[model samples]
Target: MALSTDHFSPSPDAAHLRARLSQAGLRATRQRLVILESLLTLPGHPTAEQVHRQVVRQEPSISLGTVYKALDSFVAAGLTRRVAAAEGTSRRYDADCTEHHHLFCTDTQEIIDYCDPQLDTLIREFFAAKGLQNFQPHSFSLHITGSKLANK
Candidate 1:
């Protein structure tokens, strides 16, 4: 099956993700690849159940448990990121493989990508100025809550 790299670039990072999976001694099974590829194709974040449903359409043999395991493996291998949804009821997976944030709609519980280099710089500067020695901020996701009707 062809892997979709539309949202995510098929650059060196792609190889790095694959390499990490390899280093973990993962055999890169077809099901695992399907899971990863699905994540890569989706523009918005998706829960494990959503992913499992999509995978089932292609490979009916794939189970929800298997999808969950593949998601764990991908997260462990740094191939994907599991993000908390608007309601914090379920986790969403992002395949962009970059440092970014999210904008969430409270009413619909929808999430949108939030990316800004200036924001990233400001965060680092703020931490540095405050001399935050205890907390080392690696990554951050800001869930901006707003009503969908307001947005419309």
Candidate 2:
């Protein structure tokens, strides 16, 4: 299917997304691509509702249930991940499935992605020295929660 979206240069192209979906054993549908686009473009870690709203702007006929289904399928396929939300708040989804940590803002509840090579090495070395008993380690990411201060 040919995708006619102007947000194709910096944003993920439909072809790449389709390939990813196929690799993850998912059939690449337009609805799913639009939903994934929202997940990747929306500020912070967006909830299912947020994605649904963004998707409807482009695809008016799409339903909330369909968005939820697409999100769950993406998570199961390792194409995206479900980030933990505080109690009472809705669950948030992140399109970046890379090995990176998150900086959560307690004041506004915004989630920010953080990557530190040194930290990754430190964590790996520490875990390598003191391994967990009866459990093998695959990856790790630190979620730090705090308010973001104004730029100096």
Candidate 3:
């Protein structure tokens, strides 16, 4: 199904999205496309509810349950990543599947991406030094929690 691009600020590339879904061995459905597009276009990490809200604005026929299912599918297909909150709050979804860390603000409940080569190398080296018995390291990302300082 062709999705209306009115709701999206920066319209997503439909062909690229379809190709990604195909590469991931997932079927490109209208609901999945809308959900993925919402995730890609929205700024910062958004919750499923936020995605649902954005999707329904353009595709009112889509249900919230469908949105939830699409999000799960996206996560399973490696098209998106779920970021768990430290306080056991609702989880947020990120479209960037690249290796990077997050800077979470406890005060504002904001999550910001942080990339540092030194930190990544240090963590990997430390883990390599203290090898696990049966576990194999795939990738690691750090989530530092603190409040963001106000602008002067």
- Best candidate according to lDDT: 3
Minimum summed lDDT over a 10-residue window in model 2 is located at 1-10
Model 1 C-alpha RMSD vs. true structure (Å) is 5.8
In candidate 3, stretches whose alpha carbon ends up further than 4 angstroms from where it belongs are 1-9
Q: What RMSD does each model have against the real structure?
A: 5.8, 6.4, 6.2
- Error (Å) of candidate 1 at residue 27 is 2.1
* TM-score rank order: 3, 2, 1
User: Which residue runs does candidate 1 get wrong by more than 4 Å?
Assistant: 1-25, 148-152
Cα lDDT tens digits for candidate 2, 94-142: 7778788877778767777787788889989998889779978898868
Give the higher-TM-score candidate: 1 or 3: 3
TM-score of each: 0.78, 0.83, 0.89
Give the Cα lDDT of each candidate. 0.74, 0.81, 0.82
Q: Give Cα distance to truth, residue 122, candidate 2, Å.
A: 1.6
- 1-152, model 1: which lDDT tens digit per residue? 12222254333344654665687668667787677766665557889988888788778999999999999888887778888888988988887567777777788777777678888888889878998777787777666677656534
lDDT for each residue of candidate 3 in 78-105, tens digit (9 for 90 to 100): 9999997645478789888988888887
Q: Candidate 1 or 2, higher lDDT?
A: 2
